[model samples]
Target chain A: MIQGISIYEILTVTTVLFFIGVYGFLTRKNLISMLISVELILNASVVNFVVINKYLYPDMLQGAVYAIFIIAVAAAETALAISIIINLYRQINSVEVKDTEVMKH
Target chain B: MDLSTFLLMRHEIVLLVVILLLIIGEVFIAESKKSSMVHLAVFLFGIHTLIGFLSIDYGSLFGGMFHTNALIQFLKNVLNIGVLILLLQSGDWLQEKIIRVNRGVEFFILLFSSLLGMYFMISAGDFLMFYLGLELSTLPVAALAAYDITKRISSESGIKLILSAALASGVSLFGISMLYATTGSIYFTEISYVITADNLTVLAFILFFTGLAFKISLVPFHFWTADVYEGAPISIASYLSVISKGAAVFILMILLFTVLKPLMHIWENMVYIIAIVTMFIGNLFALRQQNMKRFLAFSSIAQAGFILLGLITGDQLGTATVVYFLLIYIFSNLAAFGVVQAISLETGKEQMKDYEGLYRTNPNLSLIMMLALFSLAGIPPVAGFFGKFFLFTAAASKGYYLLVFLAVVNVTISLYYYLLVVRAMFLRKSDNAIPYFKSKVYMRLGLLITAIGILVIGIYSPIYDYIYELSRNLL
Candidate 1:
């Protein structure tokens, strides 16, 4: 364990961050904002992996490696999301979530 | 360290080669000859499917980061067959619509890339590989979902799918982190050995299951399914509904039955509830759908519910029944979607009303549609009946009698809606029915294959034995 920081403290922070992202995702109106919330959500897990690995099992590198892969995958996912959102914006005048309801039953 | 250890991944290696060859072929092949790419893809993939059936030694690789067994290989072959049928069904659309405008080869490339991802996702022995494979399979389909950029609604669907997928996967990753925190390892075999039913671990499982539920389009997470299916191309929609969902279901079952086995007491109850909720929601919503795509979307969700019935058993019977059901489902769902594709491609009409008096004009397509729907509704003399029967039997064997009774009720409800379409086609009449038209040979072949699969797979009996044998690997 780290000398100055407890694992519980770090985990508590991530729990808050994760739920904050969930709230943002639920309440956000703009597509880009929702995407940002997703990034926050992903980063929370990324931190959890790193912190948990550092505190609980300093001997193994699996958690750290997993965190790295998550970061890289998150970047790729964000790029893909932005491209799709851009296409949506081009077709419609707005990126607001309300405008995407052309497919209602 | 010898060469043969690597050959266990023959499916991935061969699929990668086919994808690379297709990329090169697209670059050199002239634009006017673009149709050849479709034929090339289908041919190469057909060869891949044939080779996949030839067994390889089952074992682990890369310090057990990757693993393959009889069960995984069988699932991959099932997927290969599904994609082949999809490609055949999609060939005409690519040649006529997509090839004329842009490099048509991309459709194949993206599809193969997604399939490659599913391969890794299912075969993955560790969390890193699993997460990577999951993302790989999903990202391409989002692009495919938005293929028709000209249609504003299509792009809209694309955005919706990507956003939901990202969020769902992120939630799942958090679950993985929790699992790691609880077990201090990401490898499934290792984690299974040390795992215990702690509160934190249960939370992790629930969060992780949200991701699978999203992919499977279980209710509450299924808001995007109907919209996405409505907006995407018919072939792409069918691909999403069957192939990827099948892969997701396989991985969910494998993980639940293996790595999460110690937590069975916890998740069985969870699966019990999810099974009931997904069925009622999927069936109830399916009854009201006017558009064929949305109708099938809801139907597929209900099928996913039924798959969970076998899942709750957590035994060999559950495993065998689910795999067998998936094979039958692929044919039945594809046949239904194939008819939709052929009709939409030719006439650009997708409403239930368009099918009225359809039998008078297009008797053959109507017959295929009726057979497909009957199989879906689990009537006798078709593969879907056998599939549903086995699933109920699997569940009943474990004494989930209430769940089984509810599923039977859902089946009856599902029959009403499925028959609604048949009613429209045969009994109802209309002035402007879809006129007689011959599907391109590839489309015909696709439909013919599905028809034969729906008719013969259940009665054949040996295929079930093979899948049952494979299921023993897990249980």
Candidate 2:
């Protein structure tokens, strides 16, 4: 599609990364690791935008701009998540998913 | 932006100024004197609500990335009213406990910031603006959920909230990217003109809907709701239930009705299944809730289900009913939570069992709680009944009789659990019941206003007609 690199190839890579991130998110017991998985998922979307912009809509820079905004938002989300994890750790002395079930019926 | 464009955002500008003044006051004022910040916030927000009603500007800004109309203004005003009530209800509790000393400023700051984000969200005309507003609204709430640093459940809820929100938003962003790739534009007007119901587009729509579903706490995505509601302070819990959820519903309704109108066939069917599941799961879980907050959380989830009935119709009547229902819901939910906050502040009890013989000790509060619950259960002569009636009628008009029937059955199921709380308060007797306590002026006033709203809004046809007129111009 573009200089020998196909849009479908990039999409396939992003889709795989997205699924891997979801799998890690579901399986990981540690909070920080799960946060990292979320970051992966967000980056997959970033990659998606870059690829789509570069290949499909090369006339406009809107998709690239959206990618930048997404990166900034992802950074902010990570900061908030880490702070919350630290707060939870201070209270329970653990960051494991198994230990956070304090409100179950 | 020109002066006229700036004038269109007067309510937001006013709020921004108030927040700045609050920050300035916090910096210059002494710790003891900083208590006045609550009064200042309440007064400013009250005035802002009044000004919002007078703001009749209808236009777009930032190359159609933001929109403002009578509908957005109306919703913003309603949110301001809800927030005002929240501030009033949380006054005594904050002054005495929870927000201890000078830390009250940060609580208000976080809340106002979150409200600001919701305002932007309600007006967002593009995907990027919507995503920005969504994150801005959400991240601060995680902090509010964990406001009580001393409580383990508080921080736990905060962690759960932020993690799930991150996952949901990320998934939604992926969907947005898909949509952008398909349509080559992020602006709602542009996308609406270009979108077609292709397979990839359908996938993108479903993913986007799922993300919003998490915000509205619909069914499978609702696992975090009760936990967060139970752990967060009563003020924050009510804010989550009413203000945050209300804003999300407003924006979601607009997006579905306008930008995604072409894909209504796909979404309507999806919403049909989600609504039935959400109502059933919410009511079933509510029956098992020992904690009052969790009970209300599930109850609100069920309410979200009923709201979806209107959403499925995708017509003027549906829009009117949803808007009207949210207004009634705000008053009804706040009244209930105000009572809980008062009782919890007076006595350190938060269980259903703790509410036994409540009527004998605090008849006024128990009565307010009963009225609020009656409205929520959609009993005759209360605001919730008319709200539910209109929603079902809207769906029925669309020939969705089965969905309407299921919703009625869900209403009946919901009434049982709502009555359970009433029964606990009125029928059961306990030796250690919370004694009669005099609520502060603000709490009483807040409850009284909501109680009046619960009673008056349903019986008055003018308000419903007015909302109907407003809903017609939503596009």
Candidate 3:
């Protein structure tokens, strides 16, 4: 909630958040953790959208509306993905990507 | 922007109707007729798509956020045909599962819904509509990616796809925000005027390009592609690789030629660098893939790199090249997947080693696989060869000689791996090879359609002329 911060600061924070998500995605072994990383990345993007919408083009709410749709879609995607992961874990008895190469040539 | 204008194009109206029917089918269709429901949906879509092609009168809708020029309409028709073939090829695979879990109509519903999204995405005239359409196209396919809940790999693929899509969408939105901040407009037409050779605009363009690169699975963003394609079901993998990527290519062509025209110098340079990297990385990875799907996944990435050559030109000829290349790509890629689907069903094996001596057991499939692989490698007398030729020519026309030269080198590298599949089928012999693997009538018919499409389009010049004229008018 820093007031009168420069546009560069907002962009920097957004980039930092995105990098953190990338790191988590790269390092995380658990599938759920990777999914969370994705959520983090998505949020970072929404934050950038909001800040830009407020500061740059207040007239066009398209960015803001798009941000909301991303949230909704991301949530739906997470629900479906998690359910599939749980189902797969039940069948294969493991969630490690290494064990799931059943269809490889 | 008028509501009536929104319904002006026959394809748009048909697309909307199909989407609604799919949603309704999911909610109201009885379990007993679910298989029939899938067929009904496919038939309905086929007819509507044909009508859309036959009734092509160019018009714009919603001010300029939706377009229905002949080129895009033809592209959409090709996509529709591709999806229909996919559905047919998947019928047997889908039938077994639908009966098991009462999934029934839901599968077709989700599929058509995804197609609806892609339709809007290809036709989108503005950033807002484009973004919306992309999400709509993507989210359902993410679900479809993990349709086989019994397999851990299916779930993993689903999760990976969702995470990747989320990141891509988010980053893309941020870029859009930055664009709006700089230009004070979200409409693509207006943004074209606002983008100058400015640092901020260039930054925004880079950010935007990254998001799209993720979708196309270019280098540095392609890690998920092999895994996801390998993990997902064959039908889903084929859909993701051909249909989703095709839609993105259409959008990319439009954006580069129209909206991002002002920043052509900046982005074209970036595209050239990316194209080379993507081709090399894709070919190198593809060579190492023991899994058939992963092999094709990497090959598709390499193909995307080739498509970028057309986009890099940023002209009417480039647009024609991309559109024509995509049409050819649909046939070649889908044929490969169709053969793979046939074999996978027969033997439940997807490894190259499993395909050892496949030629003796299933000569037809082996031949199809050989043709598909050769076409992908740009061997002459195949659709894929012409596709690459057009893409390379378009780039060379832009004085991108180095890029074209590197691309030719990459094509040679790709030929090696594609030949690997041919070698496995012909030279190596499997002890426990599948004997007389038979596909369903629909699948066989579908494969034949795609095969003929590959051959006819390659040998014919009139098709290219038609596509070129359509591109000129549309662009």
Candidate 4:
């Protein structure tokens, strides 16, 4: 384990951040807000990977490498999400969740 | 380091080459002949599928990051077949003036990349590889979902898919980190050795299951399905429903049966409840859908539920049955979707009311639709019946008789809604029914293949036997 910060403390802080990200996902009105919330969700896991790796297995680089991959993938996902949101804006002129209702019955 | 070792990765390597070929072909092809790219892509993919049936070594590679066995190779072939049929069915639609006039080849490249991702996913030997495969598979399809660039609904579907996908990825990653923290290893083989069913691991498993459940559209995570299907183009909708869901289910089952076997007691109960809820919710909601695409989306969810029956066994029976059922599912679902695409292409009608008196005007297409739906509904003498039968037998063998009974009930409920479509096409009459029109060669060929698959695979017993033999290595 890390010498200074307890593992529980790191995990506790991450747990809160994870829930905050989820809360933003549920409460966000605009697509951009939702997108940002998703980034937060992704980064929470990134933090968990790096912190857990540092605390538990400081010798191995596996968790650190996984964190890198997660970051790269989350970036790609955000780029696609933003492009699609822009496409939605082009056709509807609004990004609100309620405004994106061209699909339902 | 040796040349012989590369034999294990032939499927992925050849697919990568095909993707690069398409990209290069795109640049050289004349702008006026861009639509011909569809023909070239379909032809090249057909070769890839054919090559997939060839034999390859069963082993792990890349320090156990990549793994393949007979079962994984066979599933890859099944997915390749599904994608090939998808390309065939999409050929006509892609060439239409309303879509794909300029960017015709992007659809194929994106889809192939996604398929490449699935190939890695189902064959992954460790958590990190699995996560990378999952993301690669999902991101390209989000782009494809929004392929109909002119339509607001298409882009809306893309957004919904990516958002939910991002959340699912985050949730699964959290689960994986916890798992790594506990076991201090990411390799499936190693983790399985040291893993215990503690509370933290249980919580992690639940999160991981939820993430995959989103991909499979199981119950609470299924909210994005119908809306996305309704909004995306017909081809992308079918791709999501079949190829994508099949890959997710395949990987979920592999992880549960192999990597998480120690936690079977906890998860079987979870699977038991999920199977019932997913089946009921998917069927009941499907009954109300008027749009053909939306109807298929719910039906696919129900099919994913049926797949869970096989999963609960956590044995070779579960593995074999799931793979066998997915093979039949790919053919049956594609046939259904191919018919929908053909009709939607000829005329702009997508509602059930438009299908009234369909038999009177287009008897052949109606017959294909009937066959596809009957297979989907698990009627007698079709591949779907056998698929569901094996799944129930797998569940029943494990003495989950109550779960088996509930699944039977769900099958009966599903039959009702599937027959509803048949009733509209045959029993009801409308003056404005879709007029008889011929499909292009590719579309006809696609439907014909699925129709033949639906017929021949049911009575053929050897294929199921072969799958059972291959799946024996899993548990």
**DockQ, every prediction:** 0.90, 0.85, 0.53, 0.82
lDDT for A103 (candidate 3): 51
Write candidate 1's Cα lDDT for B35-130 as tens digits: 788889999999999999896989989999899989999999999999999999989999899988875888888999999999999999998998
> CA shift at B175, candidate 2, in angstroms?
0.3
How large is the interface RMSD of each prediction? Answer: 0.7, 0.8, 2.8, 1.1
Q: What are the per-residue Cα lDDT tens digits for candidate 1 across A4-105?
A: 889989999999999999999999999999999999999999999999999899999988999999999999989988998888888787889998887897
Q: Residue B343 deviation, candidate 2, in Å?
A: 0.6
- In candidate 4, what are the lDDT values of residues B1-475, reduced to their tens digit? 6888978999999999999999999899888778778889888999999999998888989999999988889899999999999999988888884324587777888899999999999999999989989988999999989988898888989999999999988988888989998899999999999999999999999988878899999998999999999888899999999999999999999999889999999999999999999999999989998999999999999998999999999988889899999999999999999999999999988988889999999999999999999999999889999999999999999999999999999999999999999999999999888988989899999999999999999899999999999988862
True contacts kept of each: 0.92, 0.82, 0.73, 0.85
Q: Name the top DockQ candidate.
A: 1
Q: lDDT of model 4 at residue B97? A: 47
Q: Which rank order by DockQ, best down to worst?
A: 1, 2, 4, 3
How much TM-score does chain B earn in each model? 0.99, 0.98, 0.96, 0.98
How does model 2 score by TM-score? 0.98
lDDT tens string, model 2, B236-300? Answer: 99999999999999999999999999999899899999999999999988988989999999999
Residue B151, candidate 1: how far off, in angstroms? 0.7
- Native-referenced DockQ of model 2: 0.85
Full-model lDDT for every candidate: 0.93, 0.91, 0.82, 0.91
All candidates: TM-score: 0.99, 0.98, 0.92, 0.98
**Which run of 10 residues does model 1 chain B get worst, by summed lDDT?**
B466-475
